[model samples]
Target: MDFATPRRRRPAEAIVPMINVVFLLLIFFLMSAQITPPAPFDVTLPESENDNAARPADTLYMDAQGQLAFNTARGEAVYDAIAARAAPDTPLQIRADARLEAQALARFLPELAARGIAEIELLTGMP
Candidate 1:
């Protein structure tokens, strides 16, 4: 009787390792990428003839109804709300509606200066 050695079969390549690698790359990219800034709420930024490309600071939203909302909250006193969250050195950005009255602006602009915010930027859409 002749004796022959049986050949062992090789296992197929696994996709698990590839999937793990893909997931790891995705995680790495997500971690390394810059995080999006928080808007907290949505505002329809006003339109302007002149616009600058400079990156502005945290935004303040003012509705057409003369209501002040730092992002989304409708507070009793806008100054108090601002003072509670923002520091003296924090940059200020204002996003106000086109219908915002001058009196309303006068009420808060001086207060912002008094609070020691060095510069403030008003964001608007390009016309």
Candidate 2:
């Protein structure tokens, strides 16, 4: 007859706790992150001497070649989209390539005004 008691195995660790922590971390990051749509095309913003910091909204993109994009719309269609979305009081931001011609931009401004866009802001990078 055996006098000694049999040894018991240790219980397995719980993976549920780790999974819960991982899910919690995921939730935190998702909530904290600011998600914005990428620019329709690459743009190299002009530099400015002013230190003014402004957040972009209802943005229009202009390439060096004078290509226009607003949200998913491109070229002439961009104007219609902008006209539909913009309120007379709401400001529109333009992210134009530094290499874009000033005359091209100047020509474009009247079109925006014709579309009833009153307030406009040009977004530029800091030197």
Top-scoring candidate (lDDT): 2
For candidate 2, lDDT tens digit of each residue in 57-100? 78999999999999889999998999999454769999999999
For model 1, how many clashes? 0
Global lDDT of model 1: 0.71
Per-residue accuracy of model 1 over 71-124 as CA lDDT, tens digit each: 445655666666766554667878887777868977878878776667887778
Give the lDDT of residue 32 in candidate 2: 95
Per-prediction CA RMSD (Å):
5.0, 4.0
After superposing candidate 1 on the true structure, give the runs of residues whose Cα lies further than 4 Å from its correct spot: 1-14, 32-42, 49-51, 54-56, 71-73, 84-87
Clashing pairs in 2: none
lDDT of 2 at 117: 92
* Candidate 2 wrong stretches, greater than 4 Å: 1-19, 86-88
